[model samples]
Target: MPLRRVAALLLEPMSVFEYAVAAEVFGLDRTDDGVPAFEFITAGPAPGEPVALNTGGAIVPTHRWSDVLDADLVVLPASEILEEYPGELLEVIREAHARGATVLTICSGAFTLAATGLLDGKRATTHWRYLDLLARRYPEVDVTIDVLYVDNGSLITGAGTSAGIDACLHLVRRELGAGVANAIARRMVVPPQRDGGQRQYVRTPVPECTADSLQPVLLHVLDNLHEPHSVTSLAQRAVMSERTFARRFSAETGTTPHRWLLQQRVLRARELLERSDASVEQVAADVGFSSAALLRSHFQTIVGTSPQRYRRAFSTT
Candidate 1:
């Protein structure tokens, strides 16, 4: 098999963290262990131009965006400013997709992809702070505000700065499986997988006077995420009907109460798995799962890896 080609779009005013993530994942030579390595190249909307990035550094592209007709993966690193996205940049993304390349974005880079209309009617995400702007600007897109990243086959969008590491690892895991991704994460000294979706960011503060509202209930749920609790019990404790509780919870948290709680549980479980010497069964019980089998199922499905593998790969020595 041939080595896959990956190109990162070095857009102007790029974020250093986002750019570093792509470089770390794709730019490094990892063929020492016979793993498939990507031919990583930094490209620009125009060739041979100095692209300003937020890192106080500038990148000069080896190729123009038009030169990437056959790249397997293309990345748009995050930026701080979304309102300054240029139309020419959107055109390049459109042309890239026309050739069937997988497009990935980090953090606010979703704003650039959303401008292309390719994210229309598709589930996508970005930095939690910009979800509302993305929703208002592109009402047709089903913006998932509570995901670390959304992989829609050909298009991928990440949540925040460090979440880009999770998104890239997820992509590596999908294309190369757990072992390869874990190896790469080890080389980079980052957790191969981070549990908990983007719901953690959705927990915005509520007024102190209205503390009895969903805020107090959410705090209770977070505090007891490792316990078996349900929406009905939480609603009863909060002195509101289930229907009213659900509505208010969604309005305040940007996701259903059930989904939010599950994410918190997963988050707590991952922490234990990474930090403790407990078996999967013990960790599962501590995190509210009925059994190790159930924990494994959810861990594989949502955490993107098995518990044992995550522990072995990420446990601090």
Candidate 2:
């Protein structure tokens, strides 16, 4: 069924940012921009009770917990981790999923969903800081630490902060269409899709580079993604040794030179597939891939779907 109604479940000590992310994505009326208007509501354990926020404010939800049972989609925003979650709340979550409604969690809200036992034997993610705790506490869950979000069929779990935006937009794109998702993204001033994942944001000590920065070279590579690039050639372009260039590149981009270039090529291919009347082979060559088969392999690996499927779902032309 198409997602026309959305219900956000609020818990005490909520992280305002995550709650706001849900509102920004689904609660706001965007019909003027050619996007469908979602029937959005907020539900809590006690209707009309004020829930304290982690950032020192409180919000009162107008709907009771029962309101979520029939919603097309339910959102769980981050809250302070509690020793025990309410059994009634967990039952509602399980029932919602059993009846074919989608459930999405933002940041630490994964803990609340996990309490329902629905996440057992499924891949999920949380804030990087609490990955170990979630894993240790819920041995049944397969915790993935490096991705911004995990879309395990109907259950979607987003990592910390802005990752919620990515997960929400992905769901909108999946359920509605790329045109609606893109319009919302434009109004919000954010990308409809993002490359790589949370792994790029992991903290690491980078060795300082004495030579000039590779910012210019990086921009040039992005501008000309159709051209073949190698560590040796990029090193020469930056006027540095391959070893120095590799180190600096990793330090600056959080990925190897080859991996970074491959990601960029895939992004370029996506753009061409969505905006141009090019065949798969043409897009492959235009993005520097050796063949359409190779492009399909890399595109599926990075985008989680085949090129043809993606274009069918999202193409503008």
- lDDT leader: 2
Tens digits of per-residue lDDT, candidate 2, 76-178, equal 9999988999888888888888888899999999999998999999999999888998998899999987678999979999998899999999999998899
Pairs in steric clash, model 1: none
**Candidate 1 lDDT over residue span 1-317, tens digit each:** 12289888877788888998999999989889555778999888777888897767788889987777678888988876566567776787888788788899999888889889999989998888888988998898899765789999889999888889898898888988899899898898988987666654444342232445667777777677668788889899889999988888777667787777666767777788778898889988887889999888877665656778767756874
Write down the TM-score of every candidate: 0.67, 0.66
Residue runs of model 2 more than 4 Å from their true location after superposition: 205-317
Clashes of each: 0, 0
lDDT score for candidate 1 against the true structure: 0.80
Model 1, stretches more than 4 Å misplaced?
1-3, 201-203, 208-317
By how many angstroms RMSD does model 1 differ from the true structure?
Answer: 6.0
